[model samples]
Target: MTDGPATRYARAARTWAPIDWWKLEARAVYERPELRRALAPFAPVEAWRDLAKDVATAWGILLTLSHIAALTLPVLAGGMLLGWLFQRDDLAPVGLTGLLAGIGAVLAGIGLVTEAREPTGTDPRIGRLIGGLHLVPSTLGLLVATLAISLGSADAPLGVVAFIVDVGVGIAYFVLNRGPADSGSDRGRRNLARLERALGELPPTDRARMEADAREAIDVLELRDLVGADDAARAREQRLGLLAMEMAPRTDLATQRR
Candidate 1:
């Protein structure tokens, strides 16, 4: 049976499953002086950029929780204090309101964390739902706290300013936690481009063999329907081929020209 482009590519992709493409890309980056110079300004000095991504995700979750606590804790404590000090019959209402607001803030924080952790191919509707929940509840809780403070305090102007600042911070946090909507495939294509450029500078025969290997990888990745199939694979293969080619002695004098 003759394999179609998709099938062929799939088989090719399977051949290199054990290899670490990121590590390979890193090596390529180091080998090509020109690429190193070009990328030096933008690329960080960290061992792995993926580590930074993971850390950022962790920080997002932590920060969301922190914001929730910061916004709700004072209100809860104040409710308890008012109940103790005034012995007001309305203390029950005050405490209940504070407790509900705190709970909502917690839920919002969780939603934001979930949205941040969700993988690239997560359902768009689900993501939007989580993101909306994350934003809405926290906003509502902030508004409630602001109103309550304004009503209870003699310093109305100060209370109003505090409310505005609280709302502003919540809005900023929502914006900060908003995850990028691009698919994993888009990211992969960009990485492939960098790999390709690195491969292009290697010796000719090494470049050719790497090109072949990369084609196999692309076939497996089904990068064509994603399109740029051949080019992506060739670029990766050429980069890999350079290492293999370096170990073997060259036979062709004509190889020096191109």
Candidate 2:
């Protein structure tokens, strides 16, 4: 079974129908590997593991709330315009502008949702191509919104609609560069390097044996985290401890002979 923010969102959607897609998308960003990797460089090692988990669980809540406001403002503005037009018998002209703006908003939202679903695991060039294609609706919405705003009065309903689309564009731009953090494999490589360097000080036979064991261990191990106090961290610690234990017996025998 797939496990990730997207999957969780799907489950939630099934359980609780009619959720705000923008809010879901914002919340889901925390589950993306790219966001974790970006934050890793800045987070302290002592708290990194907990921090990553907590942030993933709660980071986007406020942004999602803000997304609701952004989404609502345009709808409210359009509704108010419709009410005023009803009072003046001018609903036809103003209603068409609102309709166009509404269509643009829907298109932009669909595009944003489509773009958000593209996996970060895809090849960079192919990902970019797919992302650009997915953004076509948003780009068109932006143009339509601009036109709608220009054709309407100073209190145009499309103003807030345009702003929402602008925010969607910004989100897409931000996510484009956010790819998964390769820190797990990177840290594994570093640990292996350190082990090999230490082994170089040992006698040829011991060095060869220890190096082979370490290589095999490194290749077989799976760690969700390379640092901090977590299960993956503990596993890595145990692996290193086992390596040290293997070295100790030979080192002691050598000292006795000396």
Candidate 3:
């Protein structure tokens, strides 16, 4: 007999009604040697494993670039203004410093935009590089401004005040934009938790992939009952049903109420 929509629907309904059906399918996919071998070619073990890591890395890079750009613009602008105010006979060095810093800031802004568009990854090394880049420029700008105030033959108190303001602004920018570092274990745990939540929201037929992801996540979290107990399972199924109902073509609810 040909399998039609009715047969598929019946199978889905039966599968959805029992958690054991889902669990058995999951076990079969992993434990059955023939099924595993047949599925090996289509499995995206690396891509699925690396998805969270990529996202975290991308976020870290974007934030770092943004924070650096914020600090860079103000420092460059203020430095140029200060240099203009002090217009000594030798304006070359100060002018060049301001110009170079301004260019660097613009380049950093471009980098930020590019990084924002790129896909994220979960590499700690990449995150560290991004984080370091964010802090390095601002720190250097602060130091340079401080040195200029101390060494320059300008209005001493005014120079000091400007330097302090510039440093303060940079510090504030860093504080506001900095994101937490991604530890390898923590990233894995968070990704797993997210996968579990996503799996819990899917219908039985549509949930096979999500269930696999949830299993991987559970393994990462070392949780025995990531999907919880009978009550939790029922609640999850109800939630999925409600979601499906909402997605279905709408009829007049008022007529039904009557």
Please tell me which predicted candidate would have the highest lDDT against the true structure: 1
lDDT, candidates in the order shown = 0.39, 0.36, 0.37
Q: What is the lDDT of candidate 3?
A: 0.37
Question: Which of 2 and 3 is ahead in lDDT?
Answer: 3
Write model 2 residue lDDT over 187-241, tens digit each, in one string: 2233334434433444556434433443333222222122124422332343222
CA lDDT for candidate 1: 0.39
Q: Give per-residue CA lDDT, model 1, range 1-258, as digits (tens).
A: 323332344454433321234323333333344343322212323323421232345544655565455545534534443443355333223334445444444545554454344322223344344444434543554454454554563222233333233344345444543454222333223433553564566777644443454445444455434325553444444434232222221222112111
- Count of backbone clashes, every candidate in sequence: 11, 1, 6
Tell me the lDDT of model 2 at 233.
Answer: 37
Ranked candidates, highest TM-score first? 3, 1, 2
TM-score of every candidate:
0.30, 0.25, 0.32
Clashing residue pairs in candidate 2, if any?
Answer: 34-179
User: Which ten residues in a row are the worst by lDDT in model 2?
Assistant: 249-258
Query: What lDDT score is found at residue 170 in candidate 1?
Result: 46
